[model samples]
Target chain A: MSETTREQIRDVIGAHANLPVDIRELGDAADLFAAGMTSFASVNVMLGLEDTFDVEFPDTMLKRSVFASVDAILEALEALGVALV
Target chain B: MGSEVRAVSAEQVALRDRLIDAGHLIPSGVDGVYGHSAAFEDLREALGTRISAEARTRGATRLTFPPVLPVRQLEATGYLANMPHLAGTVFSFDGDDAAAAVQGTRASAHEDWSEFQAPTGVALMPAACYPVYPALARRGPLPAAGAFIDAGGAWVFRHEPSTDPARRQIFHQHELVRAGTPETVLQWRAQWAQLGLDLLTGLGLEARLDRANDPFFGRRGRLLAANQRAQELKLELLVPIAGPEPTACASFNHHLDHFSSTFAITGAGDDPVHTACLGFGHERIVLALLARHGLDPDRWPAEVQDRLGAPR
Candidate 1:
């Protein structure tokens, strides 16, 4: 179930991260920004996460660490009370 | 806006007091807002003139703008989303006398009167180059050599309020913008950085160029700033003015296809044009002079006086 949640977050990142490398090749701890994800792309990833999980990120969570990696995004979603399957 | 406490260093206070005592700056009972005396204005104007002359020698076209910008244009820049904390929007009462009376009452009682006010069609210009791109885009493709513009000394507004005189709410920026191929823009930006450093040194002010970043707001902004620094997208000419940290009297920014794509600014061949701009803070430069030399321009070094051309 936890892997399902991770997969969902990865799917959102793959759709919006704009990473130069394929999403499948990146580990959960990979730095998306260092992999060519721009600030604008990070904003898109945030929006995609909000839509996928039906949770709005507060201003406090609008940070680089929150969207730094797939694991980071999952952590943020969990902090926002998205129940992990 | 009113909740956060702004810290002003003792050094800043001392510097502010000195300028005020020397009759160079007139206090407006508001932190970060002051009126310039004739001497101050004269010095600032002289700096602008010197910069304009240099730009003219480079065959740059001159353009001027007022302090306010069209609200629509401001929104289109995406500044509010990126740096909303620093943006200042104009708001005014839009109702009849009755509504005015209510607003007046609220104001008199120190109550929130914002409800009675509406956003005006104009916003204070955040930077001198904000309007340049849109204006250039309307003219279709640039010349084969692209465009270089001297934006004159235009007033720009930032919302940071502080007791530091160097950090004024409203200030003039003697700005220049260049648009063309990536090579053109980068070369222009580099040339200006060297020129800017030389200009400050010629004024007898100790100046140095350093990698810099805008004070992007919020947590997300931190990442943007880091990326910007890593890419060396911004450079600032820094000089010690009032505090321990040097003040940035001038800045050069290379907007890699950001403004061009946003405004659809294209090169002669219809390729996306890259843009770059450099802005010298008029007031800050003068303050640096005062801090480095003395408040009296008459007593400055002979060479400095000669270069700035004997105060009008």
Candidate 2:
């Protein structure tokens, strides 16, 4: 993954985190679910990811578990053969 | 038509029983509240099958929407101004002891806190078409004439409470909405009304077309109703549910630029798209069918079963 791609993903995650919490404080492998990422907010994150990557999420990848964490989301994208730009 | 309505068929009884057994039919004790158990789920499943088939046939895209909506969006569409009486609100906690509230141990000093957040996420979407209009508007203009969407939703909140399963607090509504030029939109509405009537008749339910009035708003609402009587925008597919009075199983509404103008939904040519919606209350239709044809799937008329895609 390019350095820029990782930073961009981190930025997207950071921007979505609700007030009183910041995404940048978390490690690269932090658990988003534990950090209070709600199911509804996760959907918004998915939409952001899709728009940023210019790719549509396959129906199978729309489940909550796959997007539970940054690591999980990255893994799902990799499995879908979406190369980090 | 006398009071001698035929007894409910055994098949109808069985379907009701199956729903009860499956935990879909929750008994509200008063026989009104529609959400207790499996009946809601059964109705949704059955209607979903029909909607999917119809959408595929009509080349409409199948879209499932969230039941909750943002209150602000509904406000933007003038929903509150038009139908405040029917609107249900969600209130939130605002008491001083916030921690005790989370544990459900302390009652908030403010009584309203017990209910839910005010301007509740969105007024419980009363109609399936409510959300689609905004979505279309956001996508800019429609292609040339307009577009079609198959919207199927459950747990729609209506304040009315009737003992008949057909009219419950919460029910499933399956609708097809077309937004575009008046000619195309009205034509689609008319066609669907005919198709809906035919579908009901095929199910062995004796249905008739009848003019209706919008459940209009406020002091001027009477005038609105009177005007509606004049224009006849609401038309229903009525089926005899109890003894004499018929229940509306489906309705066709022609909101001539009412919604489009409100939502800024326009056609590709920059013309305001006229909108029309065909609404089917799945539970009501099912109840009417059950009342007309007995409950047994095996004994149900072949034509009715065929229309519903019930397996032989």
Candidate 3:
């Protein structure tokens, strides 16, 4: 994935994930839930990602693993055919 | 959780019919609605008494509530957002006599009369502990030791209708909620879980604790349930009722600042308090007793009768 797409994912997470820690400081593979993100807040993050990417996540992608980390979110978007560049 | 559909097994159907035939449960002709016979009520009350006695020993503040909960309280808890499919909202006809006549005519004709009914200020209580949050929030900040509320046996409603007698639409849940530091709440929940297991086993039923999750709604809810399980937020005491799958007769849930944040329930220095609740399904417990023992409480095992304080 392109750096631009990664930045976008980070931006959405920062806005919607409700994580107490700074998004920039967290690594790509950092666990969001461990960083004080709650299950209710994760829904907001998913909705934000959907809005930013202009794609709807199917029921199959609606899993904790898909939203576990920034890398996982990027992979999900790519699988949904979201072009990075 | 509402998406998956499981067919009702013949064994469940037979057990339900058997209960009805034995006059333990008076059928209301609805799938999950049934009137309890005196024996059933007495057994349920005995179980409730046993639970209440334990709660009293723990210095719990006993509170009784009606079957309906204020709609605003339900909304504040964000229950509907997660489990909309299972929530049962109240509605009433708000109209003049002429409009009432029309509504009555539609009802008599067996047509959809719900259009005449407007949403009420309240909804059927989804859980026993729901009313406790808003009530405690009204009391300002909690004391240093925190709050232990014994929400008495109140009728709670869930919209799921099934032939399985264990899965009732309306049932009495004896729930106890504790709001304090995470340690206090977690310890209280664990204590209750053990007590519940002991009580069930003492009553001659095979019961065990298992990690569990609520039946949250929709795609987002799937992730919520998974996260709940991962964090060990909920646990259920399951017992075999009819079929092979054991039914959850009671549950212990740890709400890490979910309710405290929602209801502004704070401890000393306005710190967000963690909360947890353990609820026992009185009807389901009694049903499990019946399934394990026999229909006649008088003929129950001496040890089981002694445990329940059943008249010999």
Please report the candidate that would top lDDT against the real structure. 3
Question: Alpha-carbon error at A57 in model 1, in Å?
Answer: 12
Clashing residue pairs in all predictions, respectively, total 0, 24, 0
Q: Once superposed on the true structure, which residue ranges of model 3 sit more than 4 Å away at CA?
A: A1-3, A54-60, B269-271
**Between prediction 1 and prediction 3, which has the larger lDDT?**
3
Q: Rank the candidates by lDDT, best first.
A: 3, 1, 2
DockQ leader: 3
CA-lDDT, candidates in order: 0.86, 0.68, 0.89
| DockQ, every prediction | 0.26, 0.01, 0.67
TM-score of chain A of each: 0.93, 0.80, 0.93
Winning candidate number (TM-score): 3
Per-residue lDDT of B151-237 in model 2, one digit per residue for the tens?
Answer: 865457766554445556667788788888988987887888888887778777899999986664543344344445445678999
For candidate 1, write residues B45-118 as lDDT tens digits.
98899999999999899988889999888888778877888799899888888989999999999999888889
lDDT of 3 at B206: 95
Alpha-carbon deviation at B138 in model 2, angstroms: 1.3
TM-score sort, best first? 3, 1, 2
Error of 1 at B86 (Å): 1.1
Displacement of the residue B189 alpha carbon in candidate 2, Å: 1.5
Question: Which residue pairs come into collision in candidate 1?
Answer: none
